[model samples]
Target: MALRGTNQEFGRPYNRRIVLETIRLEAPIARGDIARQVGLTVQTVSTIIRELELQGFVMGVREAPKGRGLPRTNLTLNPEGGFAIGLHVTPIGVSAALVNLAGKIVGTRHHPMARVSPEATFPVFQALIAEMQALRPKGRMLGIGVAMPGPSDVDSMSFVGPTTLEGWKGVPVRDRLAEAHVLPVFAGAELGAVALGERLYGVGREFRSFYYIYFGVGLGGAAVQDGTVQRGAHGNAGEIGHLPLVPGGDPCPCGNRGCLERYVSRDALDRRLKAVDPNATIETALTDHAGVVDAWIDEAAPVLRSAIATIENLYDPETIVIGGLASDALLERLLAATEPLMHSVAERSGRTTPRLTLSSDGQDAVLRGAAALAISGALSPRFGLLFAGEEERAERDPIMTGPSRKEVAA
Candidate 1:
């Protein structure tokens, strides 16, 4: 069903999210365009735009002259209007950044960890968050977004399982952060966050639906449809790493054999590199040991190609992007190695986007994605919040709270 909204923000946070998402995606746009895009009336869009302007979230700039009449004022987000804290956690370390409304990273702090246990990591997380909080202007701080590798709450895999960070199984990851932090806490799988970052600031800005493949210490993926990441039951919808591709070939922490990650992840690459030189890290291995990297690509291309074909057939995304931890050069080589991809649903005539693509944002995809996750929670509507008390809703999201003065007056 097409999503239409009441011409008011009285209690409809959904409308607010739609309008904000439309502006962010198609910025420098007039209110009429926003209304048409989001299926809201022009008057409703004008009212919401006025409220957004009043709240300092949006500003209007006169459009460039084209014809005789004066150009309409186009709305764009006010970068200084709000900020979000993004934290990306991995087995190696945790990093945090303060991202502005304009999707710019204003400040960042990264600290490595010998162990990723909660006891050892929380102090660093808190310290970095405190630093970010101190730096951000008051009242504009939205929330904290935590992006970590996960098959959270799954019976087959867990957050604390052999593949995941230790001591995080059954640890309400977001709840733990929310308890200690003043702002709301949002958490997501690292790959999902990466996809969100892509949607918000990268090539994904152009497509309403896209697929993302993450080649980090592990392999994972995410799907975005109609500008929103598809978070499946238990938020583990895109845990493609544990997919059994090579039956009975190798065991996985998720109690599976022949999992895809075993053959195609950073761990797989590092293992290959470490065999050649014990001290060889992924970066050094790429620069110094090109042959080994090429061989690994040759071996992984088929596994990844099959996975890509499966994703294409299932979701039929506008594009398939490969990123995360894998350097651009490596991704390019891998993409090249997977030449003449298998026939799938993506082979439709007149396709605008390529069947597969590579991203340059691999290095900071998680950190930036963590920031996007927080921003999403702050602005996106939640059906759970629909029935929750106003106080609870306000506590959850400070940005979209209560009704407009016009609604109360009416």
Candidate 2:
């Protein structure tokens, strides 16, 4: 269970988010079953369901299963209830999608981008927003979510690499986007967004906590703990690439030596392939130069294995996933090369999920995840948000509004 609900009236706001999350995950479910799963009373579920129905966020369907005792009213999230715009900012291009409350992408548009400054991106974002609004004319406009490469706001490694997004440190990204679009905006690293996307719509559906390693131009990582992305003090908790693993190893763009990513990332693989054939590219190199690929994998797999052991021992997540921009075959090769992993606490028996696995969300996972950010931020319950101003609560965190001042009578 990703989230659970409370029976107390004081916790009603959080309960609503929990109920909604459960319904979205296991739709066509009876309210009684929802209550049982979320640890809430049936009466509380009914009350929340009533409020949701009144707001058009949920709808009930009466169905009679064959040989059942009675016809049941099962609830499902209303797909048309609301829509959020998901924007994925990459150095090469921007991918935009219109995602609904049901977490489905109903429309999409893409624009090529050579630069990534606010002046360049906001205009493109405006065009895409117009297209998405035209595509779906009636739903509530929830807000916008953006996924971008990170290590932002801190001097230690702020936009320091070619693969990582540059010139983004101290940009106030979320605030700038909100001002540009005049909508609520939430932004985070691509890996965090992908983790959230997986939690909502991908292989992460069953696991409450997991670590995601993203292999794009460079390697990045993120963790979902207690059903939310664990953003650290600088919103860079999962910057696994920069971890110092190998002694006196290759220098990294982040101004560090022996960084894990220098040995195990796409750039590392490309450099190896280029050493053999100057014109080799990742796409054709896998087939045209199998030996080169194997050699690189053999060298990199040990580092990845060590990282996996560290992750398992430290986070103890249910599983660790390999994801992001690489082709499945390449990912499969890395997964295969890293076999017979080093012993760790996760080596314990009775675990249902394998310690190492690959994400099944496909190449567009980041874009889809970017879309999930808005939904997750607005719908996921945050207790501190209960104290936010009414305007902030309703605008930035709709479902997190605290209980009304009026009493709930017996």
Pairs of colliding residues, candidate 2: none
TM-score of each: 0.85, 0.81
Tell me the tens digit of each residue's lDDT in model 2 across 1-410.
Answer: 34676676567667778888788878999999998999888899999898877666788898967674878889997776767888888765688899877677888887977677767877887888788877766556667888987666656565666566676666777877777665568888887898889888888887888998988767788898877789888778888888889888888877789888888887788788888889898878788999999888888999999999998888999998888767889899998888898899888888778888788876668877987888877776663236233433443455423222121110
Model 1 misplacement above 4 A:
1-22, 31-51, 67-69, 134-139, 159-162, 381-397, 400-410
For candidate 2, the TM-score is 0.81
RMSD of candidates 1 onward, in order:
4.9, 6.0
For candidate 1, which ten residues in a row score worst on lDDT? 401-410
Q: Score residue 264 of candidate 2 by CA lDDT.
A: 81
Model 2, residue 124: what's the lDDT?
85
C-alpha lDDT values of all predictions: 0.79, 0.78
